[model samples]
Target: MGAGTGPDGSSRSDEEWERFLRESMAGAADAPKEPSARARDVAKRLRMDPARGAEGWRSYTPARPKRRTGWYVAGLLALLTLLVVALAPGRTVDLFAGDDRDSAPLAGETARPTQAPPAEEAQRPTAQEPFRGSPAARWASGAAGITVPKARAVGWMSTAEVERALARSRDFLVASSLDRGVLRGERPEKAIALINPHQRDVQDLLKTAFRTPGEKSDPLLLFSRFRPSQARLVGSVVKTRGRLTYQEGERGALQVTADVTFVYPVTRADAGGGDEIVRTIIRRELVMSWDDPDKVITKPGTFSIVSYKYTMTNGGCGAPTGYFTPPFGADRRADETDREIDPYDRSGPVGGGGSGGDECARATRS
Candidate 1:
């Protein structure tokens, strides 16, 4: 506004002129800012976590402590002790260390080479060993094989014996009543024969949904359905294995039961060239029956699985009803039972199935 006003109120000195230009340049530029809290946290975490870093061992290793006294003498003694231990006969203790005995060796006796100790006898793994196995066959039967898994038994049975049976059973089952192995140029009767060959009931059961103990389609074919043209269990775990518990069933028949959990994660080809995993978990019991407990006890493969039941605890794409046969009704939906659930007791029976039921339900069990 003045005739000749300097920007800084008075006429600009050389120093003031330089300062003004520098201030103007600084004002025109963007403002500097401190890093956000999240960024700072990430940086701090990176400095602490070795996985987030690639430094050498020396970078993280602590520095050596100051030297201590009497170390050389102790080390020398240790070295001498080690030499003595190494040279000692058969790695055994010397009972006559200081005794002056003249029993070095006979004049003409030659030295014998030391012999290694014999290997320890192999023993069966205890229950403490992880039960690495399948749960298909032997477990479905009441028999836990010749050897009692309960300990103090004499027999050689691997933990995974049941798994082998499951794998075999799954592969031999017909895909469906109509979609028999005929697709592979095999006869229907021949396909039936492949299932058990020894047992007619089992063979009949495998051929169709018509013969299931529930009078529905065979669910064993669930895995078999993917075989041949579609997919299979290889490169995946398709077997079922779990712990078996037992109780008394109708008419003194042993209810060899399992709340066992089985997981099978299968890899199959999609429409594209890449593959995807189809994972499933089936938690149920296949109630196999045998009137003569001895037959099953002696040769368990002879046991016949009459009915299979599915609990609410199961998962996957398998249908819960209609497709599966009428199970013991023991595995009926818990909500359908007419009982009140106790809030305090987590282990209490789920109430739903009423004591008085349909006459047919009573007659079926009767």
Candidate 2:
């Protein structure tokens, strides 16, 4: 049998067989090497799907992430602004400027605190008029300035009980502050009587302060006094301005708060009639409470002092003399650089608790 011959008896050469196999299976002469023209177009369309695809079926392309530089810059600016505000020094708001209870000076208010006269008025008090250049010139005289709020029932206390408590508070303020004798180093008996006896702790402390008036236990914390030998009062009048407010306590007590500012004028005891007068400004804030008569063991008309604080400007920082010694003559030290606060500026309450704030801080004006 020949290798290229079929069983039917036809015969062919090896070359013919090889050529036939190559031509039949390889391809036609016009066939493309890569793809048909239409197939090429389909491949191009698939590649361009990223740029211009139909809605949902083509390759998905996520949008570029939004830039965060602008948001970061805004956050940083806000933080810097907050830090600047926090580091700034604090300022006090005026406490007395908007007091509606005692807005204007009462009628027939003649007495006032005194100071060295301005260029227009004589430099000394001449028995007729004393308030020369005092900032308290417009303030009311003594207890007349302490205006009590209208009493009404609060918590467990009735209207009448509230009124009584208010009256007692006003009287105590007058006795401790406005009484000439008390100011001239006399005992504040009336003020003491108002204190509830059950407040043994306060009573004991008060007694100790009065008995041993020293740097730590000075009675001046509770009452204002001036040494008679050191200085003489300029006149009979002392200017005062303040208001009283009441509220219900958490423990069913009537809490009364008093904020008052007093101005006193004095001269050196041995100075001539024409000598200059100096002033002392004292501001006191005290809270007194009256407990329910039946529920608490309290006296019928007594007050329990909750807290007391004061600020005394222009009162010399002298030794514990139990008196407000206005730096007079050569006694006033020359180093008053940090003592430029205003006495009458009732911006905030006396800062320090218990014993009033910094002593001897002189004011810009008295």
Candidate 3:
């Protein structure tokens, strides 16, 4: 028989044999011949049982579906994706979501506002007072009452004293001489020296006579000089007053005004003299007014006043005998004479005695 076939002659050999054996064992009259014990044992040992023939050995339990690893892998991939999204900057994650378990905090979320500090304040200047006045006022006032070393007194000097003073004056001038020859065509050294010795004493007298009481020691006289040609021993007097008015506006600032006047003997000597000599008198008047208590609140450093009338007499002298009029007046008549001797003009005219008469005659004759 073939390796897959049974030894029986029947085509269904294994099945027929199994049936025959069952009937023989039951003792049925129509039973077929039973398979020999040796043959049956041989079939069982060969794993060729007729009952399990045709069908091969197989698992007894129901076949299980193939386990799907793809689902688990996909779930793991989703979890990774969620983790990446949560870890990214400027992103928020929900830990309580039905599918996810992990979540992380966002970056740059707790922001706050900032502020700047305030600036410091500015400082202001302070005011101070000196013996004469405030520094600004002092400069503004110019040379009010200062005295130089060689100045003379206001009284008349004796002949001998005058000569001695003149000599000393010349020496002082020589020491302090300046070379103005190139510019003015005249050597001012000689003229300046002529009055140097008497300058200080004379300045003292002027300060006392013209400046305000507290202002008497000011430096005003430094810029002034005595005009000998206009000097005279005349009996005259002068009175003056000054007032300071401050006009404060939108900005922090001040302005000042000064007014002054004079009353004196209208001497013939003062009239014929140069306007420069007369101007000195007016300047003195103004200086006096600046220091007047009733006019200005005199202090060392704080006040400044601009002189309104920086001129001699206001107009012409009312007295006919006077040679020159006040600042605003016409010149005096040449014929009128209530003579007051000019100390500087010691030499009389060619024919008589008046200041500049001889020079006038010479010019006319020429």
Candidate 4:
């Protein structure tokens, strides 16, 4: 018979096989105009040795033996053509051609949180919800976050006296750090009044700082304040968080310490019809002692400040104003110190020396 016909007369000559393949391929819409080198070799090998080539593909043949060879070859050619289209370079076909829904997250899986792009996340604050992208968003507002510890008798103080001391400490924190009036460049009278009147030097220093604020006399040392003309408070709420603790000290005094962080949202005075909000974070740690009334002549309800330290984040450094000069827009300056500090960190020792040099360092966050 012709060239290489099967024993059952099912195979066709090379010319007839080529003609049949061309007719069959005409129906494949995605078939390449020309077959690949590998495809041509496969076709040549199959035509030269039909029985060996077709042996593995017999089960896929639904036609009778007389027509099985053509049908099998045609099916394989179509499959290979489809694979070529898929693997071709610079060619792509979307499986979900017309679907409009986002396919980023699979079914039953939570959508990933949208991350703020670079130069957008930490560099600025949101306007509508000032704390939305910050950890302080979940923090309690104002005095609520300054929680007083359970009072217990320490040294010569009774439980009632200890409770009063703790309550007074919390009040001072509110007055100096969170009070709306105090934040607006107003004097922190209540906070300063809580201090012992016997500390003439301390009182004098505070008076000088507020009266004539300078590099050496910073009012920010004792209270959080901002110039009213420079900043407009975004909202009435101020986010705060921290802890209170007490212990016995030398001379039978109750040493009460408070470590607190406050977050304020404000807009520039000239931010007319604009939505630019800046968050100023201040972390203050104060150590105050109440002497035993029975043993020493101490004020009835006043506490003597032993030491005070603070970390100001997002506040304009190098400015010697009575109020905090939080950087806004072009007013942002490069950090004066290389040490990176996180304002939220409270595990370290409180009321200690800062990262050196003007107490200014880069904040890891707002």
- Encode model 1's per-residue lDDT on 60-141: one tens digit a residue: 7678998776898899989987887788853334344322111121121012113311222333212221111221211221
Give a tens-digit lDDT track for model 2, residues 95-165.
33442222344443222324332323224443344555554665788888777888999878889989988
Local distance difference test scores for all models: 0.33, 0.72, 0.29, 0.72
Stretches > 4 Å off in candidate 4? 1-124, 333-337, 350-357
* Residue 189 local lDDT, model 3: 44
TM-score of 4: 0.63
TM-score of 3: 0.19
Q: Any runs in candidate 2 off by more than 4 Å, and if so which?
A: 1-128, 271-274, 334-337, 353-358
lDDT of 2: 0.72
Lowest summed-lDDT stretch of 10 residues in model 2?
A: 89-98
Q: What is the lDDT of residue 134 in candidate 2?
A: 55
Can you list the residue pairs that collide in candidate 2? none
Displacement of residue 344 (Cα, Å) in model 1 is: 24
Query: Over the full model, what C-alpha lDDT does candidate 3 score relative to the true structure?
Result: 0.29
